[model samples]
Target: MGRNGVDRDRYQASQSCSDRFQGAFGAPRAEREQQFSKFMEHLPLAVSIKDKSGRFLFANEFMKDLLAADDPVGKTLGELLPPEEASMMAVNDHQALTQGLLLIQNRVNDTYGDERIFETYKFPLPMPEKRTLLGSISVDITERKRAEQALALKQQQLEELNRSLEQRVQQAVDELRQKDRLLIQQSRQAAMGEMINNIAHQWRQPLNNIGLIIQNLQLQYEAGEMDSEQMATEVGKAMDVIAYMSRTIDDFRNFFHQDKERQPFVVNQMVSRSLDFVLPGLKNSGIDVECREEPNVSADGYPREYMQALLNILNNARDVLLERKVKQPLIRIAIFRENKRSVVTIHDNAGGISDDVLPKIFDPYFTTKEQGKGTGIGLYMSKTIIEKNIEGSLTARNVDGGVEFRIVV
Candidate 1:
């Protein structure tokens, strides 16, 4: 055999004897080293060991793959990473080894233009050689960090959108409410105008009657032939006229004061009251008014306001028939209970509304009457009172010969 080959065999024999002696004393050192090497090689996380000088003593397969190095053992960190990063890692590693403290660091690494994040734990491994660190484990956390950042950004965007949407929705609701208030005010003004017109018509005949009676009384007194029975009868007639005027004023006051309070009332009574208020105008216009008695027809809603709406419809019918100068103007009101619903119908014998105007009749500020005479919100207010306040339905349709309004509560 050659001299070199003989020397190598001698060294192997001596190492085997030393291993057997260590095994005889306790767990074999060579066996323990072999098991530890195997465990480190198969570990999922990167593992490395460094001496107190910060030079690499050992590197496992995972560490070699992370560093992209074929032979990492005995290499210094300066050779594996940039100067700045290597210096920082060396300082941390030396401090951990000397103080016997754990060092944890999360850092971003950029090598070959590819960026990655790592979480590293440097722990002091219990070793016979005090200056040597036996374990340093690092985990790559690039994907997890990116996912968390993405989620935070999405949450922020969603919160911003929600705030914007809430603002827009609130603004729209405010605008609609404002429009509703304006419509109600316009309707109230129109109703007042109609009431004034009716009042003028009612007072004309009564005032004329009073004037005639006063003239007759004056003539009798001047002639010195005023009989006691005749005087009493004249006084009674004057008192009756005053009482009728008083009732008319009281009805108007009640209708205008509907906002004072609400009470559950019979729907039929409200309809009757509305008809009575407008009966004077209807009579002068030669229009006949009729209503069906329905004792059980009642509602829990605002009775006064609803009655005002009904009165407005009846007044409109009277105005239309008077304008047309119909030979036989007729207004019929009917009330009935059906399927837990109270239904009211109002029909008039005035000419039916034109097709072009019927669709927009309920719209605020839309009217067929002369501009100065119509405020044009009566039907609109009635719609609001029926749908929003009473949870009811109101609809108008042209009949074969006239117009009809139907309400259901």
Candidate 2:
């Protein structure tokens, strides 16, 4: 061999081939050497030989391209790569030789940004002159590794989904158990925050009115102007206000119930009911809401959750209006039949969402509001309610002056 590279050992390893074909196969040393070069150069493999110090002694065309090297002889792997990459390659090289079948996997992006995975078979090759070299033969294996990973991930996801399904089935009352339970739980939690704020706003006026009524009763009794009829009249008025507050509680509580079966309900009436829950808070923020509905428009689904989704959208609208502080904040709601499907559109003039963020608004746990001010799941739950629970489509778009969400069921 030339330059103390392969020498006597390699020639002897081909002795049987020489014996069989003699002159035709290996009689001429130059012809045998040329054949070896041609085979290695054309082989569809990353074939390379490196000295003990990792200096490249020989590299085939495939190996040269793989290393991004036009010429690799005399240069070490360290010289061919950046310091950190060289270090990583060195560690991987050592690990590959120690592995079963000397299999080494490399994950990196190609020049075109496509991801590639390479599995290399690495080992040591002893040569003449008491020298040992590192040898490796790597095929593409990118597609193979990707397919194996995809299959394994698919299997893992199925197992995880099955476990999650079993757990949800045991604890949830809803027939749909694709973590409908989790969505319901988190939805209720998010709604509870808005409910409390609305309660504080709506209760303020009634409580203040009650306080004045009590003060008036004390004044009348002190002046000897209190009569049975007068006393009862004031008491009844107070009772009516207390009853209204109780009904509000009932409205909020009933929304949390899981529906057992598909039921028909007036779509407009449900929309008005949802408004009752959050209109107080919206009005307090000076955010006017206008709702228009066509007669006899109805839907067949979990109406309560549908209303909850409406509430979520309305609450989101209210928050946005309050945040942006538009001169004239308005939320418009319209319910009608479109393409024989019940359609509800809620729109608000809050200056609309940005292009970058509008697409991800319905994605779970995606919110632009400051921490503690917004639970990103608001719109996600709204989407889950319409698409999953109600078997419909929920979509949003930037309108002329605001964002409009359309729910079709």
Candidate 2: where are CA atoms >4 Å away?
1-178
Q: How close to the true structure is residue 298 of candidate 1, measured as C-alpha lDDT? A: 81
* Model 1 alpha-carbon drift over 4 Å, by segment: 1-141, 204-244, 258-263, 354-357, 370-373
Worst 10 residues of 1 by lDDT: 5-14
Error of 2 at 366 (Å): 1.4
Query: Which candidate should be chosen as best, given lDDT against the real structure?
Result: 2
Each prediction's RMSD over C-alphas, in Å, is: 9.3, 17.7
Q: What is the C-alpha lDDT of each candidate?
A: 0.76, 0.80
Residues 244-358, model 1: lDDT tens digits:
8788788877777756555677987888777766777788778898888678688778887798679778877887887788888899888999788889989988879999999
What TM-score goes with each of the models? 0.64, 0.56
| C-alpha lDDT (0 to 100) for residue 116 of candidate 1 | 76
